[model samples]
Target: MDEKTCRFLPAWDPVLRFLHWWNAAAMTAMAATGIIFMVCGPDLPEGTEDALVSIHASVGFLFGAGVLARIIWLFIGTETARWTDMLPISAHHRKVFADTVRFYLRGFRGETPLYLAHNSFAGPVYLGFFVLAAVQVASGSSMLGLPEEIRSKSMAQELHATVFLLLLLYIIAHLVAVFIHEIAEKRGIVSAMIHGKKTFTDDERDSILEAHPLAQKGDFDERKD
Candidate 1:
């Protein structure tokens, strides 16, 4: 086993990356279109306004579809991407989990737990983001689920507004989490998400508590970079 392959390894598979980027793109398009529909509503007529709304509904449906696909993939995916990879699922690992989070609380100080999957606590952060995003998408689509024959403009507007606010807040929190981890953890966690590489010191190998990224790999010793 390569000594360099420690916890928190780059375990995001190609399919996971595909779903993430695709969902992001669809969501962006939906937000932009929804914004235009809202801002231009003042001058729009009953017919044109209705058409714009239908488009928004379509976008929401697509977003929901992507979310569903990702959720399913999460279950059937590789061991690294599976739901179990996010937490210390076994009862025996509880205290080790505590110590791992304590290490983060201490700036990943000293040798952290060698994680074969995700760090004991960091798992929750990722899971929280998924839950929040799913909720926002679902709530946003509820308005569309209402009958078009009795469509309520005000209600639709409110749903869009609420979803946007929650989405904005969640995204802000996500960025802040990434920044905090990178600065405090010294692991380049965010960059690893984007580029699939993390900088690790000798101490990092000892302290990491993830499974896939932290698990032993064969090529690390020969690769200088």
Candidate 2:
């Protein structure tokens, strides 16, 4: 942790961070409302079901918009935020990905590969999340357009329910993964999403710079530098 051996870098852009928290809040609201309906069933008071549905639908729209914006950002955002970073298209990326898998397989022990933005192993997992988000949006939208009686038994409703379950599982897995990484790497990953910076050792910094010569560096903090 010597200042001379570690550095802080700007890893996430402002727009990307905003969308991340925006979707998080929206998803939390949607999940809360959805869980209430699942637990309450038909035993709820008079207009409670209708009120919950309205809240869920409103949150769904925000979540859908956030997902769409993120998809677009993957193409037009910063070098670290683009599809290039998300996919193992290059040799360096593929190598890092393999090392990452090995690290996880070994129970988060040993040397995990360093990444300035999304973890190479997590990139594809995130891609899957986006795909699920798209499906959820489509299914929910279709259900919204259907008649109440038909909506309950429709294919869209079934898909929506199934995807919601998958999403819950995904959330649990994502949190576990993040917890492991934060403990193992001690890289300020959780804070990176909020403040757009990550800490790296001097050797790690050099390796990343070699791989990404143009990687953006954040303003130096004398205490951290």
TM-score of each: 0.64, 0.92
Top candidate (TM-score): 2
Give the Cα lDDT of each candidate.
Answer: 0.62, 0.84
lDDT of 2 at 1: 46
Per-residue alpha-carbon lDDT of candidate 2 for residues 114-210, written as tens digits (9 for 90 to 100): 8778777789889899999989988998788577789887999889989999988888999998999888888889998999888888778767767
Candidate 1 overall lDDT versus native: 0.62
Tens-place lDDT per residue, model 1, 119-174, is 55667666765676677676666666576554556565466577576676766776
Separate clash counts for every candidate: 17, 0
lDDT of 2 at 143: 83
Off by over 4 Å in 2: 213-224
Scored against the true structure, residue 221 in model 2 reaches a CA lDDT of: 39
